[model samples]
Target: MSLVDLIARADERGLAASGLACLDRCVPLLGGDDEVLRPLWSSLADGGADGDAWGERLAKARAELDCADPSADTVPGLGPDPASGSGSGAETETEAETEAAVSDEDRAAALARRMLATAPGDPCASALRAWADACSAAALQIHRLLDVAADGDGPLVAAERRRQVAVLELLAGRGAGGLRPALEVSTEGRRVLRAVVSRRARGRS
Candidate 1:
């Protein structure tokens, strides 16, 4: 099915299931660390940096995942390399103000721009970028469905979409070679997501 059709079906179903499935499919297709790393690393080189709260939140999330599964590695958005050199996880109070939260729309736009820029360069790069754009657009739509679920709509649909995104990410070949950390970050999200989908599929209420 088309991404939009999958999204619509997910929305009609529920949150915790459908949305998660979409992400499984989407992230691999459009999301990952190394791609973001280049831009983020460049941005840092450009003198922009993240804050303490941001780092701490990431650290904490990583720690929690680590405790649950020692084998997992950090995802791109949450993974910060100390070797890149800025400082400890601590952010200056002012830095906190400057570091904006990563929004779904912002990510999607960035992907679209990257896709456009990369498409003319090389065949593989163009393909990857195009896939990324598609995934990002799909993610934004899924995020909207999640917003609806948060407002008391279809939880199962939300879950399914998320899973689909993640799965698509894997299928797109972006999720390979990062088994440990990917598994860690994706475990809980995947678990909850699957449960929701399975329940819904079984016609549970």
Candidate 2:
């Protein structure tokens, strides 16, 4: 099923088959190198008391699936070349490997899981959901601001000018939330748009 469906099912059934399906997709979707996958996997490893009963078997499954520790250097196929037992093989790390090595999203997922585990009620879910939402909003806001700056002071100019300072603040990393960094990075994009338009406007005037 889709990710949203899987999450909903898991909520209803406490890690039901659908949830497992969602988890199964995580490796491919996040890619094997995603650091965020680790915490999700960890949260699973922490498992409900019931899954914990399966113990080592569950752990083995997680490892085999490549969701156990995305940051692990033992990636399949990327390992030492068999013939290169000669030790002369190029040891370049692929983008996938690099991503897996540092999946920052992992920590956020883990924190959400821990909070959810303690109180499976609306309060816990809402709090974590808010964090995710905030991150998404910050990212989107950055996009809008950049678009306005890039396209010039057109229809968006008025609205952008109003929110311009707020957008700048977000890019400066003054905001606090799960998605703050992403918002911050988006700032550079806004900067590009602002500079281009502002320069053009000045020349015209």
Candidate 3:
């Protein structure tokens, strides 16, 4: 099914996972490490039945990610991911040149931050649906902004679109069982964005 249709038809847990996965993949733009949002993901794994834990985890993730020094958001080698339940591997992104170029990257990062900031503490259906849709749009924009190749739907953006669709589909089909694979997809995207950010940072230095 199309991503929009899948999201519209999704249940509360599906909606929450959809949004979390989108933001998780874009974590690098916020300068958060891969595991920084693991707590939030864990809260979703049980299908968000525990509203209290979800809220607490959401607050904790925000606290860690909103630090002034984004580079040090998470420990380098954290324990097993709450979502993945196993070891994981990485992925890369794009950047522009002076003025406009730098603006594109900054804009991308800002969009990513907005995604994290706007995440609902309550995890209600209405709130999650809206947040999920917004995250989807922002994540795509971030990829387009940083896309090294400016061609129509560069690989970065294209892959992001696919990942978004895949996340929703996984949740739709496997329900709670889908969170693991959905998380794996987001994790790969996170590594890719980290590489892109790293390469761009190097170019500036």
Give me candidate 1's TM-score against the actual structure. 0.27
Per-model C-alpha RMSD: 18.8, 17.9, 11.2
Where model 2 places Cα greater than 4 Å from the true spot, the runs are 1-14, 27-53, 70-205
Candidates' C-alpha lDDT = 0.35, 0.33, 0.75
TM-score, candidate 2, is 0.21
**Once model 1 is optimally superposed onto the true structure by TM-score, how far is the C-alpha of residue 97 displaced, in angstroms?**
47
Worst 10 residues of 1 by lDDT: 11-20
Evaluated at residue 81, the lDDT of candidate 3 is: 22
**What would the per-residue lDDT of candidate 2 be over residues 2-95, giving only the tens digit for each residue?**
3233233222112221222223222222233323223333433354223443334434444554335422322232342132143445555673
- Candidate 3: list runs displaced more than 4 Å: 47-50, 67-102
Would you list the clashing residue pairs of candidate 3? 91-192, 92-192
lDDT of 1 by residue, 46-165 (tens): 322232332233233223322223222222222222322434677665555434565433443333233222211122333333333344444444444334365543654555445445
Q: What is the lDDT of residue 148 in candidate 2?
A: 34
